[model samples]
Target: MRLGLIKLDHQQVSLAISKLDERAGEWALKCSTSVDLAFPTWESLKSQSLQAFSPPNQAYRVRSRFLSTRQGCLTCLRQSM
Candidate 1:
């Protein structure tokens, strides 16, 4: 799965994950921004794999913080399960 994050505003960010399609040569939507943050098709997440070459400076920190928080929450949830 191909994951992405887009900063919408100061308080919001749009996060998504799509399936890689070799035939279509584009990502197919697997899941989108949701409260549960579910991605059924997601296999593994690597730090380097998520990095962007050149991203908007203003949104970088916001996105990073959001993702970091989400990752922490996910880790907690998994441990509880």
Candidate 2:
């Protein structure tokens, strides 16, 4: 089950987990960011990266992958820079 979902602005987003407290069982969370790698540099690349990911499994761990444009997205917004 999902706990919380909040969206800010300009690709700013946050997520929260609840319910399954620390007493329920073992749970692990992971976050990943993907960027374009067309340019000489992965960030400078004037392209978008689309990747495939697998779902979280209880037998292994729970991980979430998202983009992070909060830090000004400077690195990713360079484009032709």
Candidate 3:
């Protein structure tokens, strides 16, 4: 199995993929990419409400809130609850 991590900031987007080691129950990084985006595009996305996005699953939504708290995204953490 594979897991993806995406980080979006005002200036850029970063993506990382990790593959699961079933035997060890660990994840290893497989690939990553980072790209700077246009300010206008970022602004458009940043301005949108979180309500516009829905988690694909309840587990993902719970993890998303936990990660948001760890990352110091208090607003996002609060909104996710």
Off by over 4 Å in 2: 1-5, 8-15, 22-25, 29-81
CA displacement after TM-score superposition, residue 54 of candidate 3 (Å):
14
How far out, in Å, is residue 38 in model 3? 55
lDDT of 2 at 10: 16
Q: Per-residue lDDT tens digits of candidate 1, residues 1-81?
A: 123343332112123323334532122223335423432323322221243223547477876665556454485335557
> Regarding TM-score, does 2 or 3 come out ahead?
3
Question: What is the lDDT of every predicted structure here?
Answer: 0.35, 0.26, 0.35
Assess the local accuracy of residue 24 in candidate 2 as a C-alpha lDDT between 0 and 100.
22
The residue pairs in collision within model 3 are: none
Per TM-score, the best of the predicted structures is 1
* Estimated TM-score for each candidate: 0.20, 0.14, 0.18
Of the two candidates 1 and 3, the one with more favorable TM-score, higher being better, is 1
Count of residue pairs whose backbone atoms collide, per candidate: 0, 1, 0
Worst 10 residues of 2 by lDDT: 9-18
